[model samples]
Target: MRNPLAAGAATGVLVFFVCFYTKLLNPTSLPAEPANQVARSINAEDTGNNRMHANANAHISWQCLSESDLRDSINSTENVIVVMPAKAAGTSLKTFAKSCNPNTTENLQTLLSKNDAFNLLTKSWDMPGVYASHFWVPTALSQLLRSISRHTLVVYIHREETSRFTSAALHVLTQWCAHGPPKAQKNFFDKVENNNHKCHVREKKLVEILKDRPQEMQMGTIELLTCETYSSIEEYAPNMLFVDYKRANVLQNLLAERYCPKMTNHSHHIGKGAEKVFVQLQNGGTEVSLSEWLEKKSSYLEWTLGLNDKASCLVQTRTMEDNLSTCDGSFIHAQAVLNY
Candidate 1:
């Protein structure tokens, strides 16, 4: 069908051009170069401002809680939550936390909202909590009494790309070794097992096993961290600390000291533990450890950050990570609260 709006727009543009040639625009209508430049500048400013507003609006996927309501929750509890990307020591940290998350395996993978989430975390009026990863947390370290999220401390642990992916791969193998394989992977795994023997197969074989939903491999860990920290830092930086996890343990240690002082951290030592997987990939003529599954990490980041094939965007991401540092004192500016 013909588009009347497009036809009308074309006709109007042609008429305007004819008028410019015949009637000649008035100086008021068509200003001088300086005035035109000023007009363009003003229009550009308006367009940019509108774009930012649209971006902010697009980001808020959930109905947000009011600042006052969030603050009331924060004020009621000095809750702590230890969050980390999947396989990034979150399981270990969770063992130490007095969790408020629903007691189910699903809660380990669910992201909750302010209305549904913080109520549980702050439920123990006398006892605060550290709801380990996968629970939606709005807080990052900002000045107390400012933003709802700022009041609560979010301890985000950072790990290298390969280590995180390797750990994920290990978790899958561990589970598969114990339980044959989850239902999702049962088909491929059954066929593969008919041919091969154990989880000591190449990552190509394994990623293929969990091919239906490869994200379950990364486990939403990177996505959760990127969304929370990036959005928070975008809003709270300069006035906030964007400290990488290595710089933690100051606050983590303080929190640890306050709670589990005599604890022995046995799992602090790092190892791939999946030597067969790493050996298979490294020996695959690429000489890179777990290089086959590195593609999973790359593709996952592309999906998460929308940074697919853009070297500049990758550089920008790295620069942001490089900018993190510890801040003992940073004020929370609740002027704007982006979604958690």
Candidate 2:
């Protein structure tokens, strides 16, 4: 029972602590305040530099493409349209447009088209203005390149999926539960004969009914946009200008690179999405600190970042600090990438 190895390990630990204390007790050997500050500063600088290197060197993620060089063309164009996924960075694209040409608000209609709202694109009741919104696939607008004028620039925005999909599932669950469960009723179908002939089919399983719900009701229309067969934009639409979807300010950066470099900071950012219940369960009973969460989920997170970097998305101005991966916002520069 008395293992020398265990005893030796304990003794080594105690001796190491004693030596550490000895060094701490001797003030003369400790670093001076100025030297310590310098060292700390150096360490901070090194950390920042290292992160920059990692971000740049990352094989999956795309680097921030400059926007300052493209301001003129973006403002001059009259029929430019931005087609973004629901949670894509469409907001930033509009903001960038405004910044590019503040006076063009009146004349901007000729230049840009958004698909979302009246107030966002047009000032008056009716005007040929920019349209921006979450237009699900298979819509008439989805065939923009073929239907519309060839001169019209259509920017298709996208984000990394793994995290977005999980968040979307949670969003659906929360929305469904918010309506409260359907009334529980006993089956009277026993009395009815050949009920299947009629349009009204009685149901006992509420949960099963929900499970059978249409894909769009449970998951956003964007799910349909995901192609299992094709990999790149070249396969889908060759004419579309593909931007990296992960830049903090997807639209802003895109515009900045195309229009206004002066304000191109790529400033918007968002936080990671909700952790899956299964993951939490797997780490059950463990302390499961934030650090551990980040460590375990780095690879998944990086996938989004990589997608963000590679796929071109219109970055929006409204910064979503809570969930960055969902939007075209910048992410907090966590110094190192997570291994998992």
Model 1 lDDT tens row, 35-123: 78988887775431121222242231212233343334333446655556565556555655533222422242242432254444444
lDDT per residue as tens, model 2, 273-310: 43321112232433332233434554665253342332
Please list the Cα RMSD from the true structure of every candidate, rounded to 1 decimal place.
12.3, 21.0
Candidate 1 TM-score, true structure as reference? 0.51
Report lDDT per candidate. 0.43, 0.39
TM-score of 2: 0.37
**Clash count of each predicted structure:** 3, 40
Candidate 1 lDDT score relative to the true structure: 0.43
